[model samples]
Target: MNGPFPAIAEASATGETADLFADIRATVGVRVVNLVWRHLATLDGALPWAWAAVKPLYLGGLPDQAAQRFRETMIVPKLASLAGDAPTSVDAVLASYDHSNTINLFALGALVAWLRDEADGGPPPPHGPRLRAPDVALPVLASEADVAPETWALVQRLNRLGDTAQPLILASMYRHLARAPAFLERVEAALAPVQADGFLDRAIAANRAAAHETAKRLAQAISAQRPPLADKIETSVSAFIDHAIAKMVTICRSIRVARGQPL
Candidate 1:
């Protein structure tokens, strides 16, 4: 129920850990390292070990493949769509959010798959096509201090939208979207019905199951390539992935629901 392990601030990252942060952003094709990796970096040797274990798969395109498969396999209920008369700016903001979420979910899913194998003593997955990170710009994530007062208040409100009592669980998606206050408002409005009608819960459940199956398939493919790690490290990695995956599913589904996109 509590947030996953406290993430070391990017400002404090140094040496190999800092390098890994850069590599993760580059490899994952995103501007910011998701909170999941930042939290994992807090553990002794966990970040490097886990990154190394999954790097081959990432470089080999297994993550892209898994993400594609996930997109195809998962489904969710359609809700009342955003109005056709919505402004161009609103459409642009939603498009940006959609792109960012789509890129993140699959790559994060790959990391979860590799970590699951390490935790369960499963074999490594096979390599696929060698690929490079895409050349696209992601939105700048606004720090709490930098966000406008109104936007910051809305961020707080959106963070509290879910049923959970864990006040510390901040979704980076909102922080990133804060740059567009109107967009955030649209998101809040779109998600209200899903939350009220309990579709958000159902969407989260579907995402969780999809994440699990994605990880399972990845583990089977890369089972033989998993590197050795201490039992303690493995346990910690497993726990972190479990929490991260669930939170990830929640955020991913929430965004999809907001956009009236199929989960």
Candidate 2:
């Protein structure tokens, strides 16, 4: 279906509110649930393939029709959603494309991992793969097609969210995404803002606190040590305690955010 007029669409998408993280988290939660709603209409399941075939043409390259159905079914809906009222970075990237498009590896991976975790009764997996789309086969035409304002807006929001949530996503991926590079990029990008805000400082502080606690435990272990096993026991207990504390910090990280303090 045709969307709104260009200018109106642009205006609707271009609200430059500064605090998007809170907005996005709320939006995403709602949209994700909405995607599963039975009443919502479904897009063509095979359009993903059509986008892939047409992608190169927009870039001044030729077309390839293989894998069309998959693109139509999955990729199109995902992209269209991103272009919807509540957009994400993933949506922004897809909207940059013309008719030609393909499956998003990073997004696909994250979505899969998220779904898996949801099914398993846990939070979404954090770490995964780095997302990168090279210009490998994309041949640009002589004429420049301006990306839709809505698409660009979503891109900006995604970029913003990426900046904030990347690290947490990374940590989550390591535990969940099987160490895929695409997932890692999404995690990194999503958490980009977090990195900018020096969220790592919290992680570091948490680590240091853990280390100090470990050293104290080691001292205790040494005081209680007997003869030949004293040094070994102290070292083992110290290392074990340190590792444990570091792990504990991950749990605390989210708590700070929940409390609205700087992480």
Candidate 3:
């Protein structure tokens, strides 16, 4: 995690934190740790407790199942077709984030539901095998100094799409994409109109609401007890779910979809 976000850098994590980070990578089957999880590591007692509660969900593939269902029902605004002309690396970057973020969105969404309300007595989540993470390697996240000034500014601009939150935190995807700024410029060109007409916001809102309920249902299978830091952890998870994860899930999918990629 970099920039203004309060997170222990993955390279800096040691001891229990480091081991838990490894478990998260192995269990999620993604090579990189996502920003939300890293951000959680900065909170005292948050990572161990939160990860313990959700580990079974990942093992059983509940979040993966939940994420697919979310995608099926989720509204993805079709952008006008000129995007996706970037390099294979750009496509790979989009593919990887599209997979990992959507999964975390649902997994953490389930955690949020379990924290806020009682799980329904409905049947357990259906058994579905989760896909292994995409093997494509993404470039390291670009710092402002690494990219041209205008490109870095565009990264900030794209990160602000569909978000009205104050003191915005950068989405990791945008930072990674900055490594390919031309692709990001294309992304901005594609999404700028979508955001203006409010199609993007509606889609983000619909998906967020749907995911909340789906995750609530998935939370039914979780038997993990509340940790002492549940309140604080819930607050952090809710923020990401409501803000970054909620918005990016749709944006990433839209980018992939417009690029003629199958999500």
Predicted model with the maximum lDDT: 3
Task: Provide the RMSD of all predictions against the true structure, rounded to 1 decimal.
Answer: 4.9, 24.0, 1.6
Residues 91-147, candidate 2, lDDT per residue (tens digit)?
222222211122121121122222222212333222223222222221111111234
TM for every model, in the order presented, reads 0.72, 0.22, 0.95
- Quote the lDDT for 38 in model 1: 81
A best-first ranking of the candidates according to their lDDT comes to 3, 1, 2
Q: What lDDT does candidate 2 reach at residue 79? A: 11
Which candidate do you rate higher for TM-score, 2 or 3?
3
Question: Model 1, range 243-262, lDDT digits (tens) per residue?
Answer: 43454445544455646543
| Candidate 3 per-residue C-alpha lDDT over 99-218 given as tens digits, one digit per residue, 9 for 90 to 100 | 998898878888998999856567777868986789888888777889899999999999999898776778888988888888788889899998999999999999888888778887
Model 3: per-residue Cα lDDT at residue 216: 80
lDDT of 1: 0.59
- Residue 140 CA error for candidate 2 (Å)? 43
Lowest lDDT block of 10, candidate 1? 86-95
